[model samples]
Target: MDAHTVTRIGSHDKDLQELFCDYVPQVFRRADFRRWRAWGQWSDDYHAYALMEAGRVVANTSVMRMRLVLEGREVTGYQLGAVGCLPSHRGRGLARVAMNAALDACGDAPVLLFANPTVRQFYPRFGFQPQRQTLFTTTYDSVPEGPPALTLNLDDEEVRAGLVALSSEGLPSTERFGARGYATVASWPVANGFARPLRQLGSEAWVFAGVEGETLYLDDVFAREPFDLRAWIPRLIDRPIRAIRFGFTPERYWPGAVEAGEDTEADLFVRNLQLSPEAHRFPIMAHT
Candidate 1:
């Protein structure tokens, strides 16, 4: 094996893109790579660092600036994402190298991230601890009963606006909206492998379902009221769907709507980031 020298570079740098093009394919499919690209646009607001050995990328990490409105004031913070390390370079501490570079650039703003189950234990070395658990709710038997009708369409522009609106309503403290939110919703139609005419329930409610294999994934549902889970539950159950998966809706927001089940906690995990006293912060909105 050849000895490798690791170098950290910024994502905005031209060489980083070349290295990303080279290394992304080695780890993700074309579609996944594109999704990451979309996220990069928003995630890039803070800064990105990549670990390179000779001319090839071995690891990568990014930090995005965020503002949260907490307790009636705004707080600035950082959200971390786009973390990866090539398999061949896993054991060489390249991930640590990339993260340290990002932290140095971040200069002590509170940082946050939602980690995969596999890597939950890996982030604590950098002063991260479990803060909160994200919950997912699905209902099969008790769908919405005569809820207000909504016309739901998956237009890129509408989806973008919907997300921005949701962010404003939910995360009023944040000063910037990153591309990850837009890209995730924009790529939903194709990535989840389903295409259907926009579904309209009424004037104020709309639902879009993403079907993969045998499961129907409710990618996004829009409604006028934040507490109107009843309206959208029927939209999902109306279909001949075997199962449904919704992401990042905590119990506090929905109250008694989310019935506890085995997969009820499917999205449950501890967030390891905290907000600094100086930065304005608000409740984290789960939008993926």
Candidate 2:
């Protein structure tokens, strides 16, 4: 391993980093690579660790810093992702070294990430533990007049940015648990699933979501004040939305809404469980 040198990288000439993706096709496929590259919302504090061997990238890991509100108090956290290592470089301890560097930089800040079943045991070495998050769904027997709102196009950058900024007022937002999509628009639907932007008129708040079959899924929601959850199902879509589902847990409850069931996010692990139940839905567009 002494022959290798690890370096921290930022958003510069992304071309050079393509080698990392190419080396780990199974980790970051063609589409996933493109999604992260073109993702609109990127933190200036983005951090990626690269292992250089013979002047070539041999291993890598990316750390994303996010602001979260835990139990009504603001705190900083890290979302570690994009763990990759070259197949030819196996047994060289590249991944362990790279992850150590990432965690070291993170200090005592809490971290969140999802892992596949095969690699599930790998993360426990870092003190990550699986936790159950709660998400809610319910049927709307009749259409009720929702909040005053209008839909926005994905390209509505200025208005969308402003709305997102306004929406991030509260901390500890999570998908399927009131997790807002302020981290990145990609989080709106996660995996490039269907998504639509909606603005709660009077409050100037926003939400992005999509529907399939009879269920309407709220990918992300934002508001300066507590948003009327009932407004989400009725006002946003025209079809007969029989069921409304969301990752967010609102301050107030809707009349007919009830806790339908719970979903287990396999491989989703966290270190230091200060806050909880941010209904952590698997991000459709989030590659990590």
Clash count in backbone of candidate 2: 18
Residue range 1-288, candidate 1, lDDT tens digits: 122334444445655666665776575444233443443432444355777667777777766665533333555666666577888878878788887777776676656665556776777787777543322445434433454334444345565556445444442212221212232333333333333334444544344554454444554443444445444555544435444544323232343335333332212221333323331212222222
Error of 2 at 162 (Å): 2.9
Stretch of 10 with least lDDT, candidate 2 = 171-180
Query: What local distance difference test score does each model get?
Result: 0.48, 0.59
**lDDT score of model 1?**
0.48
Give Cα distance to truth, residue 233, candidate 1, Å: 3.1
Q: What TM-score should be assigned to candidate 1?
A: 0.61
Best by lDDT: 2
